[model samples]
Target: MKLALSALGLAVLTGCAAVSPQQGVDRANDEAAGFTQGALNLARTQQERDDRAQKTQTLLSAPVGQKEAVQLALANSAALQALLAQGWVDAAGAAQLGRVANPVFSFERMSSGGSLDLGRALSFGLLDLLTLPARQGIATRRIEEAQLRLTGDVVDQVTAVRQAWVRAVAAQQTASYAQQVYQSAEAGAELARRMRAAGNFNRIDRAREQSFYADAATRLATARHQATASREELVRLLGLDEAQAGALRLPERLPDLPKQALEPQAVASLATRARLDIRLAQSALDSASKAQGLGVVTSFTDIELTGRRNTAFDADGTRSNARGWEIAVALPIFDWGGMQRAAMNGRTLAAANQLEATVRAAGSSLRQSYSAYRTSYDIARHYRDEVVPLRKLISDENQLRYNGMLIGVFELLADARDQVGTVLAALDAQQQFWLADAALQASVVGRPGGATVASPAAAPAESASAGH
Candidate 1:
C-alpha cells in the first residue's frame, strides 16, 4: 500500500493537477523523465524569474538609500540563519546513514587443557549496526522537513519586505499630495478672511477654508508618520542595525505583483501539490513505519553466533588446539511480546494520526488562503475600475466649479483632499492584493505565476527535497 501511494503521490489526487498551466505541467513531466535534465529546466526557470524581477525594478520609483537595509537583512535574519543550520544538520545525517556499519568479531579461549570446556565472550564491533541507520533516516527526514519550512519562511519574509516597500512609497506620495492640498487651503483661507473683514463674504466661508487647512495638515502628518514606520520595518526585516539603517537608501520601486491570478480551485490544487508542511508530516509517517518494522524484528529475533576454542592434553602440560562455531537463537517464552506489540502499535497509530492532521491542516489553510487572496484581488480590481475613476471625476467637476466661481475655494480644496485620500486607499488595496499573492506562492512551490512544483511520494516525500 505504501509503495502504491508512493507512485500515486507524484500523480496528484486525480493523477495530475486540475489547474496547472499546460505548458508548465508538460515541462514538469519532461523533467520527471530525466533527472539531470529536469534539474536543468528548473534552474533555467528560476533564472528567468530573477531576470524579470531585476528588469521590473528599473520602472518603479522606490526610496533612496535602501542598500544598507538589504545587506543587513541578508546577514541577520533569524529565519535565514535557522535555515542554514538545518541544511548542515541534514548533510551530516545523510553522510552517516549512507555509510556502512563496520563488521563484528568474537574471540574465544579454552579454560583448561584436555577439557572440552571453552570460554565465551560477547562484544559488539558494529554497535553502529543499529544507531547509524536509525539516525540517518531521521536526519534525512529532518532535512526535508527543514527545507520545506525554511522555504515558506523565506518567502514570507520577502513578501513582508515588499509590502512594506509598497506602503512606504504610497505614504510618501500621499504626504506629497496632502502638502499640496494644505498649501492651496491656506491660500484660500487667507483670501476668505480678508473678504470677510472687508464685508465681501460671511464668516462661514473663512471658517470652512480654515477647517480644510486643518484637515489637510492632520492627514499630511499622518502620512509622514506612516512612511517613517514602514521605512523602519523594512530596515529591521533586512537585519540592519540603527547605524546601518541610517546609511540605507529607500527603494526606488516595488516589484510588480504577479500579473496572473489563480482561481480558488487553482490555489487549492497548489496547496495540495506543493505545501511542504504536509510533505514533512507524510515523511515522518514513513519514518515511523520503518521504525515499527525494526522494533518488530528486535522483539522477536534473538540472533547470535558463537565460537569456542579448546585444547586436549595428554598427561603432559601441553595442550592441543580445537575450534568450533555455533549459531544460536533464543526461543521466545517469557519475553515481552505484548510490550513490543504495544510500542509498535503506538508508533503506527501516531504515524497515521500525523498524516491525517497534516492533510487536514493544509486543507483548512488552503481554504482560508484562497478566500483571502480572491477577496484582495476583487477589492483591488474594484478600486481601480470604479472608486478611483469616480474620485477623479469628482475632482474634475470641482475644478470646473472653482473656475466658474460657482463653488468657493474651500469646495475646490475639499475635492483635492478627497482625491488624494482615494489614491492612497487604492494603493493600499493593491499592495494588500500582492501580499496575499506572496502567501499563496509560499503555499505553492515557487515564485508566483511561473512554474508548477509537484511533490511525489515516489520513494517517501523526504527524498524529494532541496538543500537538504
Candidate 2:
C-alpha cells in the first residue's frame, strides 16, 4: 500500500512538470525574458545617462578622441571616486590646526580654628613649552604626506579605470567574433539539412552539422553573456549605475603601449615617491623616530609651574589675594636615561628597518614588472605579425580550394572552423599582452600616475558600437 501511494505521488509531480521539451523550453524562455527585460531596463538607464555623459565627454573630446570605452570609464569609475573621497580628508587636514584643551578650574574652602579660609589658584602647565612646536611640526609634516598620498591615489584609480575600459573592449570583440561564427554555422547547418532532404547528404552528415551548429550557438550565447558581464564590470569600476553608466561609450581598440625606456631603478623610485602606501608608511616612520626623544627625557622628571594665593587672618580677620609663583624640576636619581634611551633607540631602529624592507620590496616588484612587460610585449607583437596573418591566409586558401573543387564541402567547413579558432586564439594573445603591459606600468609608476605620465601619443579610433 505504501509503495503504491509513493508511485502515485511521483506521477502527479512528474505529470505536471517533467523535464521534457515543453517544460525545458518554457523555463529557457522565461529566463531569457528575464534577462531581456533586465537588459532593456539597463539600456533605458543608459539613454538617460548618455545625456549627461555627452557633456562630460565633450570636455574630454580631445584626450579621449570620441572613444566610448574610455569616455564611459572616465565618466563612471568608482575607484576614482574612492580616491577623491580620501583626498578630501587630506584637503581638510591641511587647513586644520592642532589645539590642546584649555586647563581645568576648581575652588575649595575649609574651616579652621578661628574662621573659614578660602583657597584660590591659577595654573597652566602640562605639556612643556618646548613640546608644542615639535608636535605642531609633526602635524604639519603629516599634512604634507597626506596630500602627496592623495595625489598618488588619484593616479592609481585613474589607471585602474583605463585598464577596465580596455578589457571591456577586448571582451566585446571576442564576443562579437563568437556571434559571427555562430551565425555562419547556423547557415551551414540549414544548407546541410536542405542537401540531406534532396538525398545529396546522408543522415550522419546532417546530424554532425546540426550538432556543430548547436555547439556554435551555445558558445555564442555564452560569449554574449560574458560580454554583458564585462561591460557591467566596467560600469562598476567607473562608478556608474545602471542609469549613469548606460550612456558611456567604450573604444573598440586598446590604448597603445608607450615606447619608453623601462629602467628598474627609475620605476622603483617612482613607486616609492608616488605610491600612497609607501608615503603612509614613511609618515609612520617619521612619527616613530620623533617619539623616541619623549621616553628618554620623561623618565623620573617632573617639570611643573605653580601659582598660589593665600589669605592671612589678623586681629580683625582680614582677607587678601596673595599670589606667588614656584617652579620645580625632578632629579633622575634612579633609572636615569638608561632604560628609556634603550627603548627609544630600539623603536627608532625598528622603524628604520621596516622602511628599508619596504623600499627593497618595492624595488623587487619593479624588476618583476619589467620582466613581464618585456615578455608580453614580445608575445603581442608576434601574434599580430605572424599568427593573425597565417590564419587569414589559411581561411582564404580554404575558400579558394572549395571554389576550385579541390576539397570536399566537409573539408572546407573544417578549415573555416580551424581558421576561426586560430583567429580567436590570436586575439586572446593580443589582449593578454596589452593587459600585462598595463600591469607593468601599474607596478612601477602607480596606477593613476602611470596613466597620466604614459599618455598614449594618439588615441585609437573610436569606432565601436554597443552591439557589433
TM-score of each: 0.60, 0.67
Give the local distance difference test score of model 2: 0.56
Write the residue-wise lDDT of candidate 2 on 69-146 in tens digits: 344443444454345455555544542323322333446677767766666654444444335445455555555555
Predicted candidate 2, C-alpha RMSD: 21.7
Q: Candidate 2: list runs displaced more than 4 Å.
A: 1-82, 87-101, 106-122, 255-281, 298-319, 325-350, 446-468
The per-prediction CA RMSD against the true structure, in angstroms, equals 14.8, 21.7
Error of model 2, residue 193, in angstroms: 2.9
lDDT of 1 at 21: 22
Worst 10 residues of 2 by lDDT: 34-43
Task: Give me the runs in candidate 1 sitting further than 4 Å from their true place.
Answer: 1-79, 90-122, 125-139, 181-212, 241-244, 251-274, 296-348, 360-364, 446-468
Decoy 2 TM-score against native: 0.67
Q: Which candidate's lDDT is highest?
A: 2
Task: Give the TM-score comparing model 1 with the true structure, all chains together.
Answer: 0.60
lDDT, each prediction: 0.53, 0.56
The true-versus-predicted C-alpha distance at residue 249 of model 2, in Å, is 1.6
For candidate 1, the per-residue lDDT at 447 reads 28
Q: Among these predicted structures, which one has the highest TM-score?
A: 2
